[model samples]
Target: MQENLPRKAACIGGGVIGAGWVARLLLAGVDVSVFDPAPDAERVVREVLANAEHATARLISAPLPPQGTLSFASSIEAAVEGADFIQESVPERLDLKRRILGAIDAAAPADALIGSSTSGLLPTDLQAEMSHPGRLFVAHPFNPVYLLPLVELVAGGRTAPESMERAVALYGAIGMKPVVIRREIEAFVGDRLLEALWREALWLVNDDVATTEEIDDIIRYSFGLRWAQMGLFETYRIAGGEPGMRHFLAQFGPALKWPWTKLMDVPDLDDAFIEKIASQSDEQAQGRGVRTLERIRDDNLVGIIRALAAEQGGKGWGAGALLREHEARLRAAAEPAPAGEPLRLMEGEVDAAWIDYNGHMTESRYLQVFGETTDALLARIGAGADYVAGGRSFYTVETHIRHLSETKQGEAFHTTTQILGTDAKRIRVMHRFHGGDGTLRATAEQMLLHVDMGAGRASRATPEVLEAIAAIAGPQRALPIPPEAGRGISDLR
Candidate 1:
């Protein structure tokens, strides 16, 4: 994954896919300029960004780069004027795309990478009209683009290999998995597979073999769950049993010759057939609006991705591995202490799962935040991985928490820590939790004792570690006392 990302981007066309690129770039701290002649373009982009805000906040633990400014330009030249990267997401019409891509190529700097979000169109055709055709390529991303991480990168005939390289790097830096289609074909890889399944599904419905809902249930209940983790090849390899893949394939491979699917033909979309399909689809969707359904899909995806991320720390799999790696990158790239300010050690918006019955962050999540804050502090003061590996570390022996305000899901929050006192055997620290507005949301005063893991007994920290702790503690000795620092339960004396 590329760690370096451009600070400015221009997007051509602000429809569904274009708006998605805008959200992704803006959230990643890239100032964006967008051009779309559609009347409702601004509203469409805003709504998608709102949804992106909610979903992206819940999807990860690390704070994102500061949001960048967004602007709509009247003309293509105005949009791509100083953009470091340009993306074209206009409709798939060949002529329209060729015109826009060519315009972007002319206006954007010679070095800026230009990407077209065309799923099936050849990059060669898309770039044919461009003066700098070598700088243009296809960068196809999945729907609800801000949430899904997959992007297919296809290089055109005249495309510079460096353009594809830069596209891969840019997509990876933004938390996407870029699959390179080294040899370009008509539909690329993923769409071809999806088309095959979709074609079979249509035949089944047309012949009254299965309803749309039934087909959905069949996939969801069976291969879908497996696909989320193990995926097709790995899941099948496991299912191959004690003798392994070759044995299983030998036994069942002949079934491919059976008349299991009508792959050669498509059901005509006549009025009756179209009505039948639309009716089934509407019944499946119920009464939910498009935005509402998109939110639902985003929520389900967030839950799945978070669950996979959790599994990554133990026995990792596909999506989980990607989630964990991306999170690690985010964490490593997070901002550090600014000048003399208390470290912005633990900062993240509340997760959707943290909300309780009262619609605020549950009481326990506050303590969880405090614990994460302490962990960050510990890492800073030489009690981190290496110290723990040496079989001695500090354990929270006592903690007092005061909740001054309720925190809600999607609210940006951070914690600042002050070292109250530290000696050879124990340390006392005070943590203040603040909302993005600087209102104190909670306070946690914790006392930690050094323990020898091998002996299971209290012990003094080594002089080196104690010196590191005191170096930080000494700087905060003059800080004013916090109001809730020494308070007891119910504010008892």
Candidate 2:
């Protein structure tokens, strides 16, 4: 994780999953170039990227790394020309996969690891037409790739052991848990479990035993809650009390003989059945739409990942080493504004909901804007989880804000922060908000106290941190407080 790896990668296919791979890779600070025959791929990628930013900012406890630049290419060869790794996210058809893999193999470097985002397609089948089959493997990721962390890494019969190891290392570097499938299997791992659950759900719905929403409730409220912290076997073991796994299995084994699952049978995807499922699914989704659902899913994922990481030691310190590396990149990208820069500009656009009744920006949204900027600055100064874990943090003690002008909807703004002054225990900062047109919108001044997180009290800044701040603070001095900010104060005495 300490080593800096190549930050550029290419994604072949700009379909739903391919776009997701692009979003995740870009968020992880890897420059991603996408190739797809679809029209308006660039616009599609931008919209996805924008949505990804909002989801990530809300879901992640730590700051996100600066997103990598996204470029679009007309062909597969152009995209993988200089990429360190290649993610093939094309159609599920075996012929399409083989054709794309062959093209990628011909284009990419001999040593570069190529991953397929196929659900259950065997890597051997996909790589049959590849010139260097050893470099290709299945790297199946769950849907909504930006949020989910699990990646099933399967090596085909032609996939060399060294290629599998290299793929693991590369995926690990980007912060994903790459589980190596001992042998290539259909549906990999997660999908197999999901498909099993889907079958029972479909049977229930088809037989009129339950509605789609009701089935969702059953999983989300019952088994899903238990599955979050402790997985199935462990949870079942606990359910057995002190009896252990053997007893638990023996008790449940009898039920296995019953017709509880359709594991061996496949569902008919005939038109009527498809329509019934789709209509019911649409009803269950309630027209909130894909973007809305994706946001909710990503937020839930963030909460789950954070909870798991916290429980397993901050940042899941060991379970997934690659995730830690990704977290580190995020922390670096979200670093706060340096002191004395009158304005600390952040690079994110306003979401639609932030607009007010007048179609102008809301005051509260302004505060959120400033707050996020401040958080980014603090992260920059190393006042984050890792710093807090090491027992040091900065706490805001006071703030004064003055609104000057109106900001309309969809307008981009920047917050500039200045380091006022610092003493042994306290530091002062001033912030100003400016619209993209360079109009001043508001200003804020604040005081922060350094604290020993373990002791819960004020503390002196560490020399290393102080030096970093000093470097960013530069030589500009804080300006005098304006009269508007002092109006309601009792300090007149």
Candidate 3:
């Protein structure tokens, strides 16, 4: 997980994988230049990017970086020109890939890192024609690339060790889990695993043992769920009971020698067999187009990732951990308050979960936002996680909130905080909540006591904290206090 993003990137092809690369790069705030000769290249990229944006917005809660600019160049040279990073996602033909990579190497800067989106081709072969072969490496990613976080980074004979290091940082910075392959091999790890299962699946269908739908259901309902979280060996370890993995493996390992799978053979894809598979696949779809099915896949992926992120006391599990870490990075990378403005530290849309039966933003969420705003203020005054870890922090003692407007689900909103006053032992603050259109929606005023966690009582804050508080308090004192600052429920009536 790195925080530094590539300043500029180039996509050598704009097909599904190429467009996916563009979406991920642009969302991470890197300017992208793409080149694809297909007549529908721009349209394809736009549609894919739109889907990426929609799915990503629902997947994360942290403030996203402003989207970077996207451009399509007429030639490979034009696309790679001055790019700090370049990804080649052209069709899987060796000659085509070699030519494209060679052209990119000729045009891109000497220090630029180049990655190939080849699924099975060897990186050594792909970089054969390149003038700067040391910069090229395989960066294989799964389909719907913007959502899937796994990207295998495989180095070739000529690839520099530093190139692998840079590849991990660049891809990890964009929220990807870059697993470096220890040795270069065709199809790599993930695809090789899939190929074995796929071979067996074809045999099952060819022999009329099961329909495609049944095969899919079996995996999705059983090991698929397990693999999504715990993975294979860990999932099997649970099956071992009190004895653990050794017992499980001893019982099942010998079964691997049984003639239960056709892993060594592939079903003949003759005309009839092809039609049988296609017809069954069509029946499984039941009439959904490619894009509809794509959205469905994206939505399901988002749900799983988010659920994983919420597991283990919110530290996240598996891919969810990656999402959580990425969210933290995004929050930390958020631009600070412009010099004189009230600290605009938090803003987000009303999530569906935040809505009430009345179809409006619920009251609890109002307090939640205010609570988060106070957290932001505390962090500004040098009382963040580390400060609290040292056994002291500000504790909110009283709060008064007045909701003046109704906000429905999906309505964008922001909050601004001002320090009304502060002392060695106490602080007073107010937060104004507004809609995206700048309409004031609500107000909250809070009083906090600086406390020593070890003592569980009021205590003077550190001199450094007091100085930080004074700096903001001194400037905010000139602004008139909000009318609802200290009001009670009766005063509103």
Candidate 4:
């Protein structure tokens, strides 16, 4: 686990959101102590935890740290005694929430942050009675807290800026994407947008325009897919086409006043209306359990995110990019010390998609990893994309891979690159792969020849390239040559 990730967290409620917080914290390798007086808290927490484990395993490809312990505390004081962070997810009632927040504040350590899972309550009112009110703020998370990465941090009038900073760091370390609300306003950002959409949805239903399912389909099939990667503004910026946002607004902004939307007020939730919505929802679900639906949602989300992640270079364009950044952070946190013997070149996990019928990483994935490591070495030796584009590059001539142990999905692996031998036109290197706990799993020996791609074949002796290789090979010469290096197919067999 990373240093910033909380080691001990106290969850002050055990309903959906509370249990979700527990699931997220525990899975992120944070020990959790939960305090909830409700009789069903134990059962509910265990169920959500169980569901979270499977969904989360599919969500992240990196090897997660061993899950931490969970304990049920009898009272708030018992739970918050030594907690690094405390989160309160009590009922929505303002008085009930204030009492719990105040209790958590009085019982928790001065340094332990106290966050409320209130979706809309003003942090100002919630923290008014707390002892250290500065530590109390709203950290509103979306439902199914184990899956959704967005946690809105709303700092109250008395809240310290450092408190929000710590809260942001803690959430981010747990693989969440957090956005700080500039103002401590009710409903935060996401929910406020959702509320408006919900109001319009209800109005549409009340006017007999669209069924619940119809409305859902309209979003999911079209703009919803686009929104998953690019939000409203960017999605419409493309709509602007050859022109930019200003032209887009000039063309479509007038529609805002067309009275086509029923968004100003919400439709009344009368008995007949409630039943109509409920019946439609039940019909849409078609007897599927919530757990079943959750699994379906997770699988779909995984596919969508993986597709976006494939887009590689971008600034906050998609969840896939965010997922990649998260994995990078996790790898950085879990990377082993270099020990000064070999240069660590690549550290990665067997992504879920790489596993094959044998339940181990596919052979192609091994080559992909080695290829990545070689690319890394090239980039390090001043032969990056720009350099390659200049017509000088190292082209791999041969590779010898020795598969010593089977690696499975979610298994963390790292490679150390050792320059076996180098000359002006050719460089030979051996890459060793080790499991997360330091077991050597595989090895690869590759021979690359420097080429002038614009001219036909082997040509080199470039001063800069030769110097960079010598810089790496010079020190590596002191390390004994690997046993796996220089072996042919006949010799190894």
Candidate 5:
């Protein structure tokens, strides 16, 4: 994964996929320009970003990294100029892709990488009309880009090997696993495999062997669980046990020639099949809207990723490299102390899982509470994902917490943050936690350092952030450090 690199990117075609690409790129701190002829492109992009921000904030265990500025271009030429990378997410029509590439090639610099979000089209076919086809390739990402980490990178006939490498590096830097397709091929690897399974699934439903929902259940309840941590080959390897690879293949190979599927034949989009699938899917979805479903999906994905990551180790455990990149990003976005009055109040809750055997909140859960409280204060002071993407960040350097009243599970809590002091490189903050009854439950004091994410070290805060802190601090109350917290801070110091 690339670390602390900044690049300007342009997204061509502001549809669902295009907007998803914009959200992911901007959240990763890349300055993005978007262009689409649709009248509502700007509004659509804004809504997509908003949804992404909510999902991202909840999905991540750590605080989200800074986000980049978003700009809209009236023309394709204006969007591609000076961009380090261009993501093409226009309509799937081959002619439309050809025209867009032609325009981008004419405007963008020779060295800039251009990637298509095409699902099944060959990159070579898409780049046929480009003047500099070597710079063009496929960067197919799954839906809801902010949640899914997989990005398939495919190099076309004229695409340079270096371009592919750069693309991998670029996507990897942003916490995505960029699997490279060695040669130009239709549908690429993941999609082709999915298509194969989808064909069999359709046949099963069409032949009354199973209903659509039943087929889905079979995959989700069985293979999906195994696929989450270990992929197909590895899962089968484990299943074979002492028999090993050859023995495993021998057992399964015989079933391949059976009349199990019509893999070569395309299912006719007949009215009956379409209606059956549509009604079943709609029934399964129920009355929930698209946004609601998207949120649920994103939350599930986050839970799975977190479980995998934690199981592996502290960092890079399950997903390894990609998860590490995400950790680095979170570390870069920790809270910093504000200036002036410094005290800010924010509300939160003690999660049910944070309770221990006694049914009260555990000791470590207090730290998490204070941590979230600090995040809220920072977010209020404009220290959010967008802030970090601009090459500025905050890191916690010191912390002190005092336990007072023991809070039980399901109790609501509130935190008040106070800025103690500030300098060019560091700021001090104090927090007090109150239980549902407004009784002080705990107190915490911390010191944070401004950081330059690119340099991977302490650095001075930008004037904008400093000024925001100053504004918030000006009218706030003094740091009312509780007596217990004062002693705790003294001991820690």
Candidate 6:
């Protein structure tokens, strides 16, 4: 785990948001002690954690550290005793929240940081009754906190600047994007925008302009996609038609005063209105329970994030860029190779997208996985991104793959590489693909040629690279050659 990660953390509530906080912390390999008075608090947290693990297994391709331990404390004091980080997610009532924060402040270590998961409450008020108010701030996350990367960090009047800095690093290390609010204000940024939209949505439903499902369809099928990728200002900048933001504002500025939306009007949330909204939402859900709906939402969100991650030739955009950075850290933190075995270079599960019509792992993904293994080997031997940028890299010239067994979606897999032979400009290698249970699933034998990208011709590897390669190849020479190596189409036939 990285140094930015907390040694021990505590969650003071186990409702939806609190459980989500616990899930995110535990999955990032931070031990968590949770305190919530509800009899079902442990069960709720465990269930949410399970969902988080499932979604994360599909989303993060890099190897994760072993999961951290989780404990349920009998009281807030017990939970926060030695915790370095504490997050509170009790109910929305300001009085109740203040009392809880006060308790947490007194019970937690003097140096421990406390964060309140208050979506719209002012952090200044929440920290008012606290003894060490400097360490308190708001860390507002969206529903399913484990998946959503955006967390708004708002400092109160007394919040220490250093605490804010430390909070940024701590949350960022666990795969979150923590944006500091410029000033303390109710609702912060995201919720302010959402509140305006929600108000309009209510008016639409109240006046029977659109049903709940219809409103949802309008958003998800249109600007929601735009917001997912380019966001508001940038998307409208494109709508500006090359003149940029000024042109956009000039074009749409007049529309803002057109009395088109009842955004400022409040809808009566009387029982009748509540029933109307709930019934419409139920119809939209089609009888799915909350747990089922949560899974569905998580799966959809994963798909959206994954698609964004694949954009821009894989450099990623928006949240995808953040996901890529975290994955890079995970790769850097991967465990070192064992002393006497083939280099265990790559590991991943068969993604749902990798399944074929016959419900087995598709043929092309096998080649892709083997290709990634070869990339890992190159990265290990001093021929990584920087080396390629300097105009030299190894390109595979030939490959032979023999599929030995079946693989299904979500089945865990890994590849081990054995150096067959190596010289100045060429190397031959064998890659064995194995299932999670250690069954041999496939093997690929490949021949690669070192090339100068600028000259587009075979070239000797730099001495440093060759030395690293020799260090790996020399010890492995004592190992016997794999029987599957050097086989051809004729042999297979």
TM-score of each: 0.86, 0.74, 0.86, 0.78, 0.72, 0.93
Worst 10 residues of 3 by lDDT: 336-345
Best by TM-score: 6
* Candidate 6: 10-residue stretch with minimal lDDT: 332-341
Q: How many clashes does each candidate structure show, in the order listed?
A: 0, 15, 0, 0, 7, 0
The residue-by-residue lDDT of candidate 2 on 316-429, one tens digit each, is 533323344465565564454444445444544444566788877788877766665665566666665678779888888887777788877556666676776777577677
lDDT per residue as tens, model 4, 87-140: 899999999988888888888888998889998999999987888988888999
Per-residue C-alpha lDDT of model 3 across residues 1-493, encoded as one tens digit per residue: 4355888999989999999999999988899999999999999999999888877876765667898899999999999888999999999999999998988999999999999999899999988998899999999999889999999999999999999999999999999999999999999999999999999999999999999999999999999999999988899999999899999989999999998988888988999999999999999999999778887888789889978987874568999989877776776787866544577766766767678999999899899889867766776678876798899989999999999999987677888988888878999988999987999999999999999989889999999999988877887777888788778888554
| lDDT per residue as tens, model 6, 1-493 | 2888999999999999999999999989999999999999999999999889888877876778888899999999999988999999999999999999999999999999999999889988998899999999999999889999999999999999999999999999999999999999889999999999999999999999999999999999999999998989889889989898899999999999998988778799999999999999989999999889998888888888978876774557898878867876776777766544588777766778889999999889899889867877887798866788898999999999999999998788878988999999998999999998999999999998999999999999999999999988888888899999878776544
**TM-score of structure candidate 4:** 0.78
Candidate 3 local Cα displacement, residue 323, angstroms: 2.3
Q: Candidate 1: which pairs clash?
A: none
lDDT of 5 by residue, 1-493 (tens): 3353447899999888999999988877789999999999999889888778766654454444457889999999999989989999998889989999899999997789999999889998987888899989999999888778899998888988888888888887777888997777888888889999998888887777887779889988899978877878888987777987778888888998998779998678799889988888888888888778876776567656756754532333445335645654554444533544334344434545568898888889778767756655565557655676677767887888887789886466666677766777776777888887989888888888888989898887878778877776555545454455345434544
When 1 and 3 are scored with lDDT, the better candidate is 3
- Tell me the RMSD of model 6 versus the true structure: 2.3
lDDT for each candidate structure: 0.84, 0.74, 0.88, 0.83, 0.76, 0.90
Better of 1 and 6 by TM-score: 6
lDDT preference between candidates 3 and 6, better one: 6
Better of 3 and 4 by lDDT: 3
Model 2 residue 489 lDDT? 42
Off by over 4 Å in 6: 378-393, 424-427, 460-475, 491-493
